[model samples]
Target: MKRCAALCAGVGMLAVLAGCSGTPEETPVASSPSTIGTTSAPAPAASVPPAGPLGSAAYQAELTKLEQSLAGPLRTLTRVRTAEGLTEAMTTLADSLDAASSQLADLTVTRRLTAVHEVLQDSLGSAAETLSNSDRTEANARCGGVAYTSQKVQRQLRADLSGATVPLDRLGLKFGGTLPDPGPEPKPVRPSNGAIVIRSGPTGTGRLKITNGTANDVAVSIVTDGKPPAKPHVMMYIQAGKAATISRIGGAYHIYFKSGADWSPTRRQFGEDCSFQKFEQAFGRNESWQVNLEPTLGGNAKTTEVEAY
Candidate 1:
């Protein structure tokens, strides 16, 4: 009995050992041959289409609409105020671009749509660039016009103020001169025939003389280089043969010959005589001077001469 029990215990131990030693059933680990050396499929790549022409028919239509909207306000601004009109036009353009951007933002990403997407992007970009450039140009032009007009008006006002002259009647009262008989009828002032002589001095001084050869008193105006004479430096006036000296008023050297007057010596008077003296002084002694004679209706004389001084 003891031997049999010992043998039985040994047998139990052997069975446990065999159970532990048996190959694990591998849990039937189902391995796939496909997974052995295969890689996972790659995620789809984003597609980019090639850009197309910027001025396609569709793009041209949109461009036309934008241009027309801009043109009206631009034209109006050109004729009147520019700032407000330009601003309004720019706002409209921005709104249009915003709408376009919204449309572009909603585009669905797809490989097949890549080409269309690229074309749209290029067209939008080109349009935006063009509009921006146009806006800058228009704004600059408007600002320049405003500045130019402001300067012109200011200059004209200053000139009118500086050239203001006291009426002859007021001056007579100050001088205690009896009012000349209310003249029955003064003859119409007429321009006299004369030759304009321009001379240059060694010291860089320019001299102008007008000699009257005709009999009728003439009203005459002298223009230099097609520009009206400036006051206080260059001056224009009629003179009789009496040795009267006419002077430079502003930028003009002028002497008017009375119908019966011969040549006269005129003193140079600036400021009071001419308003544009500062501009005229730019022509130095060695420079050329242009003289234009304008008569009431029918006579016009134009001549140019360089100073010999």
Candidate 2:
């Protein structure tokens, strides 16, 4: 109220100044409360930004419908007792999924929620495939596949919704609260013709993390030729897009990786004669190190330098 009064006072003073400057003749000033109507007019309103299509009543209603429709499908999916029953449940689920996807397909709101639709589609499609597996011998593979895809999708949905997600009251499945736990990552298959191992230098103590980015299997090992370390060197096998961590006793060391018939070595010996800054100098403690291997010429593997810490 005080601020509004001050603003009005400033406006009135400006008006009085303008009135005085207009003419040499004396002009009657409207200063009394009775003259308030002639003195000032209401201030114009501040403009508000539009909320866009996502904020539309129709879009929010669509979301509510989607959340509600999942109830019957969720109940069916969670109560399957046999493979045939599972198939029937998935048929219903797939239909619900199709309907949900279609609702958002052409809408501008779908752009931000693309991940939600992808998760729904993947879960439905994989569930159908999982239940269609007739080979008893491949039961584990079928179960594993479904578990992997569903777990990842559920986790993503949980993260996307955060904790305040609305729950499906009828189905008892809350978006963020009812997500399944993450399953262990599947092991990568090493091709028959995988990368071979090159000879490693002597080992030393430190932390060694190896990342294989090339399209081959890499056999990495830590070696120390300097001070007799407390921990022995360990060999790590990593596939493409995978990594392995090893503990090394602190000392000067070298890294070696082998791919195919070629044996390549890291150029620098870690923790060897080189010294760190006074503050960074190791105080009877092992410093952390990471080595990333990438494909070089013909078939050799070369280490890449990247800041990992």
Candidate 3:
């Protein structure tokens, strides 16, 4: 009985092992390849409408009036003065014309007449100033003062003109229709990058050095707090290296430097770089050696007492 029971148990185990073996999973079937080819449509092209007439009858009439107004004066100026003056006069005339032109230029397109007008006006004003001044030096000095102010004015005008022109150009195209060939594209403006360094001279007599580390040439000015010492002379020297020398009897305090042809005051300031109360004379680039600050304050003063180089 025991042998029979053991044999039965082994058969049961075999049956269990056979049940564990299962059927293999079926592989998925893919669909047939499609016969249709890719249908990529071409992109639609931009439709440009044909150009129409340039200006309205009213606009044309106004332009004619401006041309007449400017012509005689411009021609007279051209004949009498140097080329510089002639150029200025012509520019002014062109600007005036542009101002008139802009009124029509926008029939709804881009108009730059206002900008042109402003530039011309400025050029005319500067020219007039130069003509009235006693000498070139005075004229140049006046011109410098006007430069920044005039630039700001022109920019404002340009913005206003642009606002007017865009709508006009469009209106003309949509309604009155047609214009002369579009004016030239605006010239691209390239930005500049650079740095300016101002160094003060030694104690009794000192010099200031300006270095132009930029691609373009720049102008600079030197100023001192309070009246300069008697015989006070402040000189400027420029180029790649070394500060200018100032020869003075007394030391100067609170020295300042201004940058640009416009001479805007810079952050650089000196308190006690040199011990003396003032400098004596203006120095220029011709002198290579920097003025010594040590002697101005007396023997005991530290070199640091002079302005930080």
Best by lDDT: 2
lDDT per residue for candidate 3 within 1-309, as digits (tens), equals: 000111111211110001000112322222222122212221111122113222243333433454455455444442432324533543443444333333332222113233332332333334333333323322222323323223322343334334434544443412111111223422332212223333344334333323333232222233343543221224342322222323331333333222223222331221111121222233332222222221221222121112212
Worst 10 residues of 1 by lDDT: 14-23
Cα lDDT listed for each candidate: 0.28, 0.36, 0.29
Let me know the TM-score candidate 2 reaches against the reference structure: 0.26
How does candidate 1 score on lDDT? 0.28
Cα error, candidate 1, residue 222 (Å) = 12
Better of 1 and 3 by TM-score: 3
Q: What ranking of all candidate models by lDDT puts the best one first? A: 2, 3, 1
Candidate 1 wrongly placed segments (more than 4 Å): 1-83, 109-112, 129-135, 143-309
Give a tens-digit lDDT track for model 2, residues 1-309.
000111111211110000000113322221111111111212111122123334223344554555566566656655555444545555555455444444333334323333343344344334323333423312221222333333433344344434223322222223322233465433444432223222244444456555666565545544454422222144455665676666544454555343331211231111111111111111122545444454333321223332100
Report, for all candidates in order, the number of backbone clashes: 44, 12, 27
Q: What TM-score goes with each of the models?
A: 0.23, 0.26, 0.25
- Per-residue lDDT tens digits of candidate 1, residues 40-118? 2211111231133222233333334433443443343334445455445444443443334333333333333234334
